[model samples]
Target: MPEQFGILTMGDAMITLNPATTGPLRFVANFERKVGGAELNFAIGCARLDLRSKWISRLGKDEFGRVIYNFAKGEGVDMTDVAYVEGHPTSLNIKEIREDGSGKTFYYRYHSPVLTMEPEDITEEMFKDIHIVHLTGVFMAIDRKNLDIVHRVLSIAKEKGILVSFDPNIRLKLWSIEDARAAYHDVFPYVDILLTGRDEIKSIIGTDDDKELADFAQRYSISQLVIKDGGEGSALYIDGQWVRKEAFSVTPVDTVGAGDGFDAGYLYSYLHEFEPAKRLEFANAVGALVTTVSGDNEGLPLLEEVLSFVNQEEVVER
Candidate 1:
């Protein structure tokens, strides 16, 4: 009776500002608010791929939180585990986008409800129906209490034989590098699959050397190790063999949340027990699709769309 996937994360619904000319926030007039968060993006992508995904988070009882709630509900992500904390305000970020799609982000989440998450918020009953629990390193490195909550959830998931997927979505602006590294080390033992970028692996694991990366994967007993390289390709290591795939070509509108989309595509394929090469190819297609549109999760493709892109065919039925 377990759902296909459960995600534990914090929501930072974003306000993306596209000014006529990017200069300063004060001078900008045009701004658009969109629901965004790495975990939510992942959930939305999975849901679009026709997988049952539940997202867990704590949000403030405010309009911003409502925006995220309404968006998630509309996107088919289960919000049953999300809590509306009484006094806190929802977290938000402002990103100033240039014409080329690259942007700078400023966050205002110091007192957001998500930062106040306690271990008690995650009940034992929540995981009883979750086949896979997805976590991000950014939330794990937020603070000690949040880290403890992560440990608790990971422990319970392990006890129930649920697969644990970790995305080391490292955010250096939120915490120090040393702390992030330590937190990664602490959580590695419980991780069944690691979805991370190649640069991130080098920074956190202390080496980009092929042999060392292989040793690190072996040491952690990671069943599936996925290394994503933006626009270059992705490499997958499983069953003691390595499979590589080239990134799909696309004109990027906004690069944010592309990684989350990739994760969703791979997880969807994984649940269906696809071959490693097929999974990587599907994942790359999904990631590429995200860049075709603006916003975080706006460009997540459905199953047929991704299949069409991968097969180099056009959508003729529509």
Candidate 2:
């Protein structure tokens, strides 16, 4: 591990409006407001788990931006690099949740403040004392122009010898699969760890075969490949082998942000150098726990909560 345990991320934050009742957005009479963003959720999740989480991005100089900034700060996330822009309204999303707990997010991120971020804005000085840079596909998918910023950051991380962790949180609503593949291929060479979903990998590369996946990792020279299997558990590939763990049973209230929790758990464990199986177990537990609550990052647990949930001893060596 580096001299510091800080994890850095960048992306746009949005005000999420969830329906108060189970119905279509056209019929919903009431809604609950919350803050959400893939990278922001991961930062909050890491901070909750005792990691020094730092976020870098731009937000509109508006009320929604203030809410997101305050929320992340309240969660103990470092926001020294967050800036507010004028003109662009902060992005927002509307949630249409069904009776079965499934939901759809309608994004209103056009002219997003984050889009104003240029590749030149990312600098090596910004990565000082940062151990790992966590990135998600949602931000990359927001706009193809964002790819320049991502690539610039990856190059800096590489030059600084900082580990890079990526989550391909594919949102077809944002871009096409072909576009994702073309862009992500360039990113693969710079990534040190990959935290992805089972179905997502299939869509990204069109294969779920163990050998094929292993080959894919080898091609990218990725040291850690973690697959979130949802309720079935998770699978991890490291040190030339694979480790699988079953998921924890829980009554899910909302599954939205569970994967972000899983990424935080795994990266936290990886930073601590836990055994491979323990990493999967820990990540699975965090993901499971997130589903027990509503709102993004709301269910991301603190160190004590995770320890208790996993039935592990309280004093984990950091």
Candidate 3:
């Protein structure tokens, strides 16, 4: 009825690395090449729930790019819109894991092919079958041209009566705090749903309390605002109604992609008309489960697995 629950996500994909052992920093590293991008992760997460998801970005005509392309296609994501540039290379990010399960990331993404993306790459016809257009703040850090492209895409989606979901996946390393503030402010008015973390709100809006953050979002006329606080769970505000949901108790082996997983889970449930409280619970459970594995998408549970866990109280929704 809704065009097969189509989701269009925009972001860059990269490879990740992790340490092999749990003892020292000098140990040999266990290398794994996985597709990692906040928006892309959300798209794949939607695909896992049987949604028709498409990822839009520019990739290099190289081996790494091929790997990422094939991986997305294998995951059932629509890659027909992905542009392959001739001279640029794909982006990469290495995760250096410490013995105590902590990790650090180093990105090699400057001037990458994805950053060279232009508005011409996306056409108005692209929105013909899409239901929601998902965007992230990280893509805003790429360049003015790339940011312009995102703006164009969102603007087109809004005009076409498509829902717009914005995730402020803030990365301080990418741009200055001032730049982040200005960029987010410019795009805030166009976002229908705002998915963000408490820490990100404090950093972006300079607030810490749930009510204050919710009020701020309301001031912008956002239809739905979801604030995720890791471990403490999350809170949602929709149509002047508010609900809080706690996180599942799980020993996280790696916490890299948990937030993205949460975004995906919530969107998946929301599209299906699941109750807000249940959506929060399912989102938190999915985020927790992703941490139980090493890579980002590797640990994301399928719809059936999530339902089983929910049914058994192995993961509570409220």
Q: Quick one: best TM-score, which candidate?
A: 2
TM-score of each: 0.93, 0.95, 0.92
Tens-digit per-residue lDDT, 1-318, candidate 2: 544389999998899997899978899999889999999999999999999999998899999999988989999999999999999899999989898867788999999999889999987889988999999888899888999999999999998999999999998899999999988899999999999999999999999888898899999999999989898899988878888999998889878899999999999988988899999988998898889887787888887788887985453332
Higher-ranked by TM-score: 1 or 2: 2
The segments of candidate 2 whose C-alpha lies over 4 angstroms from its true place after superposition are: 1-4, 99-102, 312-318
RMSDs, each prediction? 2.4, 2.8, 2.9
Query: Which tens-of-lDDT digit does each residue in 119-199 have in candidate 3?
Result: 887898777678788899888886756678878987898789899899988888988888988989988888988999988
lDDT tens per residue, model 1, 230-314 = 9889998888878899998787877878999999888878877888999999999999988888777888888899888889999
Which TM-score value belongs to model 3? Answer: 0.92
TM-score of 2: 0.95
lDDT of 2: 0.90
Evaluated at residue 289, the lDDT of candidate 2 is 82
The 10-residue segment with the lowest total lDDT in model 3: 17-26
Residue 105, candidate 3: C-alpha displacement in angstroms: 1.2
